[model samples]
Target: MQSTSNYLWLLSDILGQGATASVFKARRKQTGDHYAVKVFNHISYLRPYEVQMREFEMLRKLNHKNIVKLFGVEELGSTKQKVLVMEYCAGGSLLNVLEKSENAFGLSELEFLIVMECVVAGMNQLRENGVVHRDIKPGNIMRVVGEEGQSVYKLTDFGAARVLEDDEQFMSLYGTEEYLHPDMYERAVLHKPQTKKYGVTVDLWSIGVTFYQAASGRLPFIPFGGPRKNKEMMHKITTEKPKGMIAGVQHRENGPVEWSEELPVTCRLSEGLKLLLVPILANILEADQSRCWGFDQFFAEANDILHRTVIHIFSLQQAVIHKVYIHSYNTINVFMDAISQQTNIPAPGHELIYEGHSLELDLVQQVNVVPKTTEERPIILVSKDPMTPIGITYKEPDIPMFPPKFDLINDANLAKVVTSAVHQLLRITNSLMKCQDFILRGVYWMLAILKEECRKTTQQVTALNVKLNFCKDTWMIIQKINSLLPQMNLTEVGDVHVKLQSTEDFLMSISQNVQKSQKQLDLITAEWSKSNDIHHKDNIIGKVQVLLDKVSAIYHQLKKDRMRMKLQYNEEQIHKFEKIKMGIHAKKVLVLVRDDCVQKYHKLLTSVKDWMRTACDIRKLLGPIGEQVKNLNQNLENCEASLNKTLDHCSSKLHDEEQIVTKLTASTAHLDQKCFEMVIGMKQLKQEMEDISQELQKNNMIIQSGFQEA
Candidate 1:
């Protein structure tokens, strides 16, 4: 036991090590209470007294659940070495957790959320106390397991932290290089002479980089070589942006930024989470300090996510998964409203099923939903409308196996036994043939339904494209007319024009998406035509599902764009502009165009709902067909083997061998005829699918012509 002046503690194990200090797990002799003792090394003692005391002062002043609580400073008994004792965190540092193989791709969403909440709370406390933690990284964050075995993260290691106001500038270089702000990075890593002082916003950059790494398991910016080997290249990539370069990401030093808004494939976050998180990252990771969001906005955005009730929803009819973010206190109706907005389906007509039981909307709340839900077991949404077909669930049926051997037989009863075995084999094959025929009919019907829905959806998309073009042209005209009006308020006009331009770009994007969807639909149809095996059909169904999800995403974006445009085109603004002759005409035309767009959008939503229903029905039908195909093939093989074995045995044992052999051969030939017929039916079904694809193309052309005429 190592005794201090007033306390006795045994240093059991080393917890961590750094350049200037080493922390050890220590226990008190009296109560056996555990604590972490951070002992300063020779290097730390050489620092200026004020610089060393800054950490102890900061730790003493801060008090929060998310910040590590500081115990007292103590001295070793005989050696008289000074040490700082603090609350012990059993779960270790967050860096240790992140380094685990299970978290190689990053922490799970729930765990990441916990980290975000704790870090934000701790940082908010720092802001309140007017302190800056210069070194804020994963290594400095410690995790403590709660009574319920949940992780609670707290900030520690304030060695580089100091008291600094929001506007105060610090000239001292600190923080890990990879997470440093560009200005700091230039001085710290590139060895460039930097005269500018860093403000509190530097922490925001570190937080951004840390959060991004926690989610993606890798740094955002990387040079062709590596972060350390190509420090100058990283500096250039961080500071310089060529045309068309994406912010905060550079795979190669001088190369253009990759053209993707998505996180890396290694990221474990869901699409819905990425949607909410990426915007925050964009605001915080800005190289320009003037543009970066302060802690206030960061807290607001992060808290909004933390406080929400997160649940994954799987639409059984659409065969798509969606993530819903809502207030925990909200009822199921509110949750359904969010789902409706995402899916473009009516809220009243949704029936949520969980764990094989229908959830009572009036009795359940969003808070209760999350605890019972998981990624593998999301709440299932079923359509309540009677007209909607209920999807058929499939289970593999038990297939009977042939007996390993025949019962004991003699030459006297050989003919009787052989005849019975041949008849049994024939019956089994006949049953399989009938089952195959039934599955084939179901496949054909579902395909026809899918084809009709695809045709309707394609036409609706075409009509939407035409309407969006008209709206764009009218907005352009409005911009021109508003510019020419001498009486127009230039600032107000400018804001509206910016909104209009944004809407125009969005509309253009929608047009491109529509064209892409059309091509995807055609490809799916072509694939369906060529599909003969169950696995091939499954792939085709998945493609259709992906296309539906894309359309739903477009629908939601359109709704948002329309609302913004409507708000910008306020009645008062229109009346004010209507005084001029040209302005009056263009303003009225714009109003007409907006109304037309709303109507078209609603129609598109209806088409999408119908399309999802049909596609789901096709998938449901395919499931059972796949099962039947496997069973039929297995039984056919068994029957053929049994028949051949019986014939060989009877020929060797029976006096009338030729007659018995001839009868068995006839039965085998008859079974083959049935299989041939089933194959022919499948070929015919393929031909019909090809015909449907042709008709879809022809209908698309007609639909375009009608839209142009309108």
Candidate 2:
């Protein structure tokens, strides 16, 4: 067994003790190299030698610039203490530094960048090597003074390190209370913490927490009140938003003291540096793990920042080598100056007669540029591939698949009006064609006659501000004649009233449908007023005029129907008078006249009912057609827009494809030139070698001839 004095001389002093091992300050017996030695008690205490060996194997594999280096391990037979030797950091852990240096590291921009790069680089290497230092905290980070001006940081404590390459479960009370993630805390609370199958990303998250604390001078998360406040604080770390209050507002009103606010930065940094640090801190402290930047991305960004800093500091390539300047502008101002000096294809709706073929030239696009100085701008030119066949198919853009129009008419009331009008027209037309009975034929003819009369009335009604007084006066005159000539009647008044009421109700039922149709027409007119299609505007205008004429015809028809019905009333009155005036029981002409007047009134009512039904039918047809015209206008506009988009997409793609073809052609030309030169060089070299061989042979022949003569 090794003597106690032999190892005692190596230890600086006892530092602390824990459940598994006791820590001591140790030095090399000969070289006086200082180290922290953690000696585990016995084989009984560490029965799972396999687990310890696995951990030791992982720690030994970690050879990062920032990680603490392992020295040696010894087994003391007598004491059965497994001893681990490591390089000692005299400046102590980050926690000790925080306590001594007043809250945190007051690092400047360059210094912070340097430290951050070192930390990220170390962690990145660890992750790449498939190792995870699960227990990352301020207590594990050790700052050591370097030779002269160099400052170095060491990431110590690999006892909690795990190799993720293994499929085995890794569970242990492995991390400090203040650095565990919320998930880790919950698991610990349940006593079923995930000890295995955890990844290196977890280690990265812990490091991010460490960074947040270091930058802001205080922990990002802190608990208000709890028995084990530090443990609660760690749970709050990655979950809660830090209430960054002033220094004086640290304590809670009804709870224990949480953390102080973010301590002020003593490190005077520039705006660029502040911007850089703030985002990093925010990312580090983000609650969502997915949001946090991965170690690879973080290091890449850090490397770029560091390179930019270096460039700024060094200020390389400041002087110009060779300078040339020129200013030129067009001088010609002749009237015959060509516009753009570019070829023009025929506009849309025109045929391009090319190479004996009648080709369609669609004006798919147009562009206008307003340059600052027209004289300075270069003239644009038109170009095309000379080799392409005239009849070759040009590609077009794909059509976008969108929902059907009229699906937008979501109001039930409007839909009913539209559908009802269309269906009623269909029903009326079908009934007129299919009905075969004599009564049905007479009814149909009467309805047709009433519609024709109403059409004449509509002409007068739709005219500018024409009053109904003329029609009223004519009816009054007819009534007076019936009264004076023994043709007036007053019976059947109830039937007249019932027929009038029915006509009024039908009119009322269709009032909204008529108004809706009018509104849609008005909207179309308003849209056209703003902008019109250059080619088809006049055609649409003509169609609108035809529609207006149809409406006027229907309006005049209604007016004529009203006038004819009044005439019919007069005829009915005359017939009733003939019956009542004669008395039929021998000469009661007075009573007969009164009965005739009643019949005339009933006839007027019947005519009005028939006229009203015809008017309703006319309005229904007009309303739906008006709606159809409006819908067609909207669809045309949508088609125009979609066509414009298609044109743009096709143009862009064609331009890109042309550029690729140009590049390929250039490459092919270069290769052809190179091959030609190589062929010429080979011919020249072959001729030169032949000449040399001939000269050598001639010299040998001369020597042999000379020797033979001698």
Candidate 3:
């Protein structure tokens, strides 16, 4: 987007909208660049005051070109709606591109690759900066159309982004649930004593999901109708195998997945490219964070694929117009058609001249018109009739894939030969994998059991603990294959099928064992009963301590095993293939060596083995946990006995006291009657003695003294 202004600014158009903000394309009042202004309305009260500011601060500090650039923040009148000025991306978004595609599926393999490269690069920078893009979808990825109409993708929208302080974890629920990591969703579902925390890894999961959507024009994890539809989406994201995520309509015999639906014909992806694509997808969609690929690993893996997957760009000099421009991935026919539009000449009557030869046939026959921009040569487009007068020159800007050229180089055969060699190498890899299918089947079955076990782990970890990372990666790879591989129809790239199986087996084995150990752990945890009842009795704390210790040991061992795998697995092996290029064939055709590409294929196989090994650690961490469970059970029994004894003794004492009180009451009543009778008798005896003394005192003076004494 371009802007030329010198007065008051004006809103030209609405760019987009979200729950909290609305973006618009605006003209600058001062002479400068065009920008998008994000306006936060009264509905901003739906969130917090600092929420938008946090995003602004994040963008302000981030200076990477892949990340959206922030210009300034402003407030409109009265309501004080905040407006954030930012770089205007003229190319729109990947989602818009997919929606506008003539084909149902989406962009071609080359276009997808370029966009992904930029997205990954941006993500890497964010991770390094300790930021997690909680929301990562096609809508959040913007495209910049350069002056020459070439495109570059950039990451945008920090509204859902989280800046980690000292890399601390986030416990609050944030971001779009559709793109939320499965673990994060599970956490939201199981908010009671939330055990899992959201980290930067969640961003990768969203990236993988976005990748799948871009490749297949549909989500791998479909959110269906229901009250718990969100949970269902989370479930699918977390559970589906990478290869099986985007299943095709008809299952080809021994196809990679059950839903092996064919891709749109426009995406003419080769089998060799698919071999690289599937594994990377699997790596990203891995459900287990421990087993998922890191940013560095993903970037390196992507680079490897790019090296093997070629997309040509070309330089063009229209001599009749004395003008120059570069264009790529366009065929000679398309180029001619464009020229015909520009000059009003019939495309059939025009020709693309490279080294004075017409390339009309090549342009018409190529699946997608790609140019030879990688080489240091240029081609010319001219009228087939020599008598046509030279036209006025209209110079165009240089393109990304094409450069300025005078002497056209026509060498399309090299690509064909290299592709053929790549085909043969794929067959060899496929054969190797087929030979070991039996072993892989064993591993596959085991992993399936493990996958089942993981699903059953609802007790120990709520949906929260299980985020969709590794699984998303797998889904992306399969989606790519399903969306693009159908058109290629090449049987040679069997290596992809092998690698996918390898990943599944490896993931399942490690997961199955860990889960089995976890299952044992969960059972133990359940038996211990963490009932929140106030009257409940048990040595829960002591037992939990043991459980924690036991689980930690097993978890640490698994972690150590992963580190070991990383140390041995090298993605930098691209250096070996970097320098092995063939010399130009007498400056006639660009020479390509089949041997070098073959070696690269062999290297990929080795890497696949390494990839498999990373997920192959199925070592049992169950022994200590089992022992702890036994101890907990025994401790529980002892607690039960002590509690029962104490309660029984207290009951007996209460009964004895009740009996003693009843007996004491009865004795007191009898004793009171007897004492009353004795007192009455004593008083009567005293009166009788006094009467006798009075009679005696009347008889004698001596008796008076006795009476007086009485």
Using lDDT, give the best candidate's number: 1
TM-score of each: 0.52, 0.38, 0.41
Q: Residue by residue across 216-297, what tens digits does model 2's lDDT show?
A: 4455555554325445444544455453321222246345444333443332233334444555555544445566566666
Between candidates 1 and 2, which one is better according to TM-score?
1
List candidate 3 segments past 4 Å from native: 1-12, 46-50, 165-168, 187-194, 223-237, 240-268, 307-710
Per-residue CA lDDT of model 1 for 42-70, tens digit only, reads 79878899988888888999999999998
lDDT of each: 0.60, 0.42, 0.48
Ranking by TM-score, best first?
Answer: 1, 3, 2
| Residue 163 alpha-carbon offset, candidate 2, angstroms | 0.8
Candidate 3's TM-score? 0.41
Give the poorly placed runs of model 1, Cα more than 4 Å off.
1-3, 6-12, 77-79, 241-260, 328-337, 340-377, 382-710
Better of 2 and 3 by TM-score: 3
Candidate 3 per-residue lDDT over residues 583-641, each given as its tens digit: 11111111111333224323433432432233232212322333433343343334323
State the weakest 10-residue window (summed lDDT) of model 1.
Answer: 390-399
Residue 169 displacement in candidate 3 (angstroms): 2.3
Lowest lDDT sum, 10 consecutive residues, model 3, at 582-591
